[model samples]
Target: MDGFDRFRAPPPDMLVMRPLDSMVAIFHRPSGRTHVVASPVPEILESLGPDPTDVATLLARLSERFDLAAGDREALLARLGELEAAGLVERL
Candidate 1:
């Protein structure tokens, strides 16, 4: 897969979350670190479900849940890269 076409969220049990006003506090069990995130970060993780997915499929899943602009592709990719770096998402 090219350009981040294969990715997945960590298992559901690996994460614990708390809503903090406009942001979210995420406890990543494996990393033993808490990450504060906003907007598409959590949404991306949720949309990833329990399976690895390509970028197109992931975008379709997200679109089903939110009004994603056509131009948001780059932003989506950037966010996925960020999540991957943070260990919140995994590359396959």
Candidate 2:
């Protein structure tokens, strides 16, 4: 997917995540599955609201807000792919 293709965070009613030290465990209600992740994944999901956010905007936001955040552009894209596969994010 390209940067122009928007992505949406999982609906709050359907997905929930709780912090576990530096990592987080995201519980997907519909799928009845949990995904544990760290760093940019949780931050990325938090920045993604109910509205769709393109990769460019996501990257821009992260760059602007975080000084020591992990993952460069390539890694960020890969992380997005992982989130999509986990059903934590969806294409718009």
Candidate 3:
């Protein structure tokens, strides 16, 4: 997908996540498994929630929190995609 396409969020019921001090804990209740991943920046963890956040919103928040350059933003998003693909986090 192109960069613009990457900005799209996944559907709800795909995953759930909770942020801790230096990491984000993702739970896949349906599969009865969890993943604990260290965030690149602690601020990113703070921006996540039980509520839904679209990819654009997430990137925007990250930019504001970390002042990340475009490349950094894309890289961080790639990591998030990996987590999502693992079913650790859902689109909702």
Candidate 4:
């Protein structure tokens, strides 16, 4: 997979998310940890069972939900990359 693939929605068993204040907190239950995350661009939290969604799908959803501009999309993806690398999230 390429770098973009890492932005996927993550596997069901490996993740959980809840809305908190204006932010969303994603949890990696297998590791008993969580991270508070937010994006100016909107997205729906989806559960994909053992499998995870692809990054393109996620970007599409976010773009649709928030009508994000190219710059916003890039920024949001960048922040998500940081979260993923921190083990606060995983790509399936």
lDDT of each structure?
0.87, 0.81, 0.57, 0.57
**Which parts of model 4 are misplaced by more than 4 Å?**
1-6, 40-56
Model 1 regions lying over 4 Å from their true place = 1-4
Candidate 1 lDDT by residue in tens digits, 3-60: 6579998888999988999999999999899999998788998999669898889989
- Candidate 2 lDDT at 52 equals 85
RMSD of each: 1.5, 2.3, 4.8, 3.9
Q: Candidate 4, residues 11-71: lDDT per residue as tens digits?
A: 6657676788898887777777777777441243452123466666666766665666667
List, residue by residue over 8-85, the lDDT tens digit for candidate 3: 232335446677776777665677687677755224434654456666777777777676675765686676677568
lDDT of 4: 0.57
Which stretches of model 2 miss by more than 4 angstroms?
68-71
The TM-score values for the models, in the order shown, are: 0.92, 0.83, 0.54, 0.58
TM-score of candidate 3 relative to the true fold:
0.54
Model 1, residue 74: distance off in Å is 1.5
Q: After superposition, how far is residue 75 of candidate 3 from its true place, in Å?
A: 0.4
Error of 2 at 80 (Å): 0.7
lDDT of 2: 0.81
> Between candidates 3 and 4, which one is better according to TM-score?
4
